[model samples]
Structures are given as structure tokens and as C-alpha cells.
Target: MIQKLKDKGINVIAIEGNHDRLFDFEDLSWLDHLKRENLLILLRPSVRDGKIFFDEWDGERGGMIKMGNLRFYGIGYQGVNNSEYVERLGELLDPSFENVVIVHSAIGGSSMGLMPGFSKIEEFIPLSKKCEYVAAGHAHEKKIYEIEGTKIFIPGAPEYWDLSENGEKGFFIYDTEDKTYTFIESKKRKKIERKIMLQNGSEGEFSAAFSMAVDENPVEKDSIYSITIEVPYGVFCNVNLAGVEQKLEELGALKGRVVTKWIGQDSNLPDSSDDLDIERQIISADPSLGNYAPEISKAIDKLKDLHRSGDTDQSSMVIDDLLDQIIGEDGI
Candidate 1:
């Protein structure tokens, strides 16, 4: 694909998603290879504050490239909203010449999910309107929209396919001279959907349901597939999750790749149990806070012990001492 784009005399930029850093180690390792070969420009996400750092690329995001009467302004995935960086991009845009903005990360999916909020695009759109078109990737579905008169294009994933059955996998080509965009969709790929229900039944019945679900949705040996199962809670209580996983593997229904998730009510709950509600509240809260609350509570308990052991008094004398310190009435 890189060679094909190059043959068309178009500059190709490759952007990395968070997932690419994981299972796709070879691509991450080949960053320098692309740079050396001059085949494509590679942009990677920066780590900062538990999210991709957008500010690190403020002064060093993209460079200017001249293509015929068009001036392509490249922006990395970072610093899309910084005022100074946006102003810098604005300065690069010339009214006399057509402009194209090439970006790796657009405002969707991983970029949107990982970022704190959705305000960067607002800051970028105004400056981007000065350009003829904006080409972006990272979104797994192709999309084109006009924001503030700027044509925003997301070509979607090139070869990476989505597990969702409805996902569109494709690429885009923009003719700089004619200001036209073309989307090329991949060949039709086979998709399979499997649903299994394991109600109050014997072990053999449950096993047969699982087997039939797999058989009914056999995946093409070469096609990508996804499986979603809705199992009532406690169905797996006596049954081994690992054993079920092995059974699915034996069925060979996932074409070597399988992603399974469970969704259902906690049918295993007792009618008089209070544990579920309290546990649910803690589980639903912010994960970071949930992790720290127990430690904070433990510290408070220790402080209470100190006070109860006569290390500190909670009466008029203590209040008087505190007031004296506040007024600087006590000696330092």
C-alpha cells in the first residue's frame, strides 16, 4: 500500500494507535526503517499524564511540503489545540495557494476516548478551513464531514479490520490539484455472529448450546470474526471458564482469533444479599479513587487509634490550643 501511494506521487504518513504499540511490535520497530527508506512519514503517540501527550509536539509537530500549487501542512497527533501551535499552523496557510492538512489522529475513537474531553477539534477547525482538505486516520470507519468550511476526511484503517460486523475498512485518496477525494473500500469480507444462552439446564444441555452456537456461526478460515455471548451470571459459577474457553478453541469457530464477552443480570444473587449493591457502587466509581479510598480509610483508623490512646484530646483545651496557633498567640 505504501508503494502504491508512492507510485501515485502522493506522500504517505503512517500513524500509530495505542493498540499498535501492543500486539503489533513489528510495526513499532519499523518506524526508523520507514524514515530511512523515505517511503512514509511515521507519527507515534506520546505518553504523558496517563494519556497521549498533545503538548509535547507544540513546536515540532509538522513541516511544510510543497506539491504543485498546494502547500501541505502536516500536523502530528499532538498539540492540535495549543493556541501557539494552532497559530503557527495558521501562519503556514496561504490564501494564494491551496493547502492540505495531513494528520495521523483525528477526533474519534482512540484519540477521543483517551483524551480528557472534546475541544481540540473546535480549536483546529477554524485554522483548518484555510486549507483545501484535511486527511486523517485512526478512526476505523471512513468518514467525511465539513467543520467550519474545512473538509475533514478520515480514511479509516487501511489493512486493520475491526471486530465489529458493521465496521467499514477502507482508505482514501485526495487529488491535490483537483481538490477531489476518493474512498476505496476493501473487498467484501465474511462475518459471523454467535449467540449462546445457558439457562437453567443440565451440563450436557449447556455444552450442546455452546457447541451449536459455534457451529451455526462458523467463521471463514481466512476472514476475521468476532463472537459475543450473553451468559447469565452464575452459569459459570460451577462451570470452569477456562474449560469453556478450551471448548471454543476446539470448535475452531473463531478462525484462530476469538474475542468473547459476557453480559447479563446477576441471576446468582440471593434475594436477601446486601453485598451486591455496596460492591456495585464501589466498582462503578472512578478506578483511581476506588483504589485509594481503602488506604485513606486505614490511615484515618490509625489516627483515631492515636486519639483514643490519649495521644490527643478532643476537648476545650485542644480547641484553645488550635485557636492560639491560628492567632499566633502560642510561641513558635
Candidate 2:
């Protein structure tokens, strides 16, 4: 693609993310080819001591590019630098000329979580009014938001990744003369977000819920989907994650690709098990607890207390012991 673009007298500037380096070392022939063609490839530095600093030559860390009537300043990862890169880039912008800022990171709730007190999004508000538009990547979902007469375009990814099944995979074409931006959709596969609600019930009920979810959101063989299971508290008592994975694998063979399977706690459930039997309660009270250790530790403690109080009739004391050992070793 770089060769084709360069052949047509178009200057192609490529920015490499963290994931891009892995493939570069594995199969670097294409990169060599692009380098030979004088393509501007911006390589990101490795993270050291919890910080990833960018150099000026690293696509100007905060620099400017003049393309026809538009000036583009590329901002690598705003969340990594806490929008310092964006702020620095803003300083370099020529306020007189029409400009566009291109970013390789996703803004808003998905990538960097919620930027509450920082007002990082607000920083771009003034810049948007100064520039013609802003183009960004990293997010797989295609979105465009106009704030203060400035258009923030998340062109999304040209390829499918993660839970972007519902996202539009495309590129953006910004006409410098007219100052208009248009989306050009890619020929990549489509994705879908399928959620399943499992009420407080037995293992069979959970399975039925999964089945029903798949049935309702029937995906094509080539389509990818993210199946989010909202299991109520105490409902997944007998549910097996491995079994669920196997079932999903089987379903994948029948219906498209099941890229990710996430299990979330129902919001209606109690926050803690103070009133109910903690041993019977699910270890995760919220969807965010999937990999959170503190919540897992609390659940382990509850189970241990249940075992100590001789409430092992329906629950497994052995499992409680194992969990305690694991949590103790990990210091969670």
C-alpha cells in the first residue's frame, strides 16, 4: 500500500504503535521496502520506568507537517502523556493557517478511561476551533464529534480488533480546498456486540442464556462478535468458565468468530454480601472485577469466613482453602 501511494507521488507517513514493533522484528522485509521508498515511519520508543517519552525526530514528538493548504501535527498517544503531547502540539500550531491534528490513540471512555478532572477533551476544544479538523485512530469504532466548530474524527481502524464488531472500519479523506471530511469505508469484516442476560439461576439456565444470546444475535460466518454475559449474583455457582469457552468455540465453528467472551455481574445485585451468604455469592460483583485482585480477595475472604463458620454443606471448603492460599501468595 505504501509503495502504491508513493508511486502516485503521495507522501505516506506511517506511525508505529507498541504492537507494531512485534511484527516489525518478525517480518521486516516490508518495512525495508518502505524505508527504501523514503516513507516516513515514526517508531515509538519502549516504555521505561513507567514512562514513554517521545523525541522530536520521532515524528516531531510534537511537530508540524504542511500538506497543500492544511498543516497536520501528529500526536502519538495522548493518554500516555496525559495530553501533554497534545498541549505541546497546540503550542507549535500556526494559528493563522487551517490545520488538522492526527492521533494514533483513542480518546474518550474506551482507551484512557474517563478523563474527569483533567479536562483533556476541553484542551482540544479551543484547538478544534483553530484547526479545520482532527483525525485520530486507535479506536476501532468510527465516530465524528463536532465541538466548538471543530470536527474530531475517529476514523477507527481499517482492520477489525477487539470489541469493534459494531464499529465502522474506514479511512477519512479531508479535502483541504473545501475543508470537508468524508469517510471511506473499508472492505474489512463487520462485527457485532451480543450481550446475554443470565438471571439468578442454575448452570443450565446460564447455558440457556448463552444459547439464547447467540440465537438472537446470529452472526455471519465471517463476522466477529463480543459476547458479554451479565450473570446475576449466585447464578453462576455451578457455571464453568472452561466449559463456557468450549461452548463458545463450538458456537464459533457454527457462527462467525467469537473474538472475546466477557462475563459481567448484573447491576441489580447487591454491592456486597453483608446480608446474604458471601460463600454462595459470585466472586465478582461487577463487570470490572474480571481481573481486579482486591475484589477477588474480598470474595476469597468471604468464602474463608463461610468455611470457618461451617457453611460447607453446599459450598466447597477445599476451593476456599485453595483461594486463600492463592490470594495469600499473591498478597491480593
Q: For model 2, how does the per-residue alpha-carbon lDDT over 1-332 read when each residue is reduced to its tens digit?
A: 76678789887655543234333253344443554557654433333475543333333332355656666665543334536656655655676887767666554541212321122456565475577777765555688767677777887667755432455778889877776668889987556666656666467777787777778876456555556555544344456655665565555633333322223344444554342324323344445333444445544554543333223331464456556666666665
Give me the runs in candidate 1 sitting further than 4 Å from their true place: 4-29, 41-62, 79-84, 108-119, 161-166, 176-179, 187-189, 201-203, 233-332
> Model 1: per-residue lDDT, tens digit, 184-234?
887654655565555653457557766676667764555544444444444
Which regions in candidate 2 have their CA more than 4 angstroms from the true location? 21-33, 40-62, 110-119, 192-220, 225-232, 237-332
Residue 83, candidate 2: alpha-carbon lDDT:
65
List lDDT for all candidates, in order: 0.51, 0.54
In order of appearance, the predictions have TM-scores of 0.60, 0.58
Root-mean-square deviation of candidate 1? 14.0
TM-score of 1: 0.60
- Candidate 2 Cα lDDT to native: 0.54
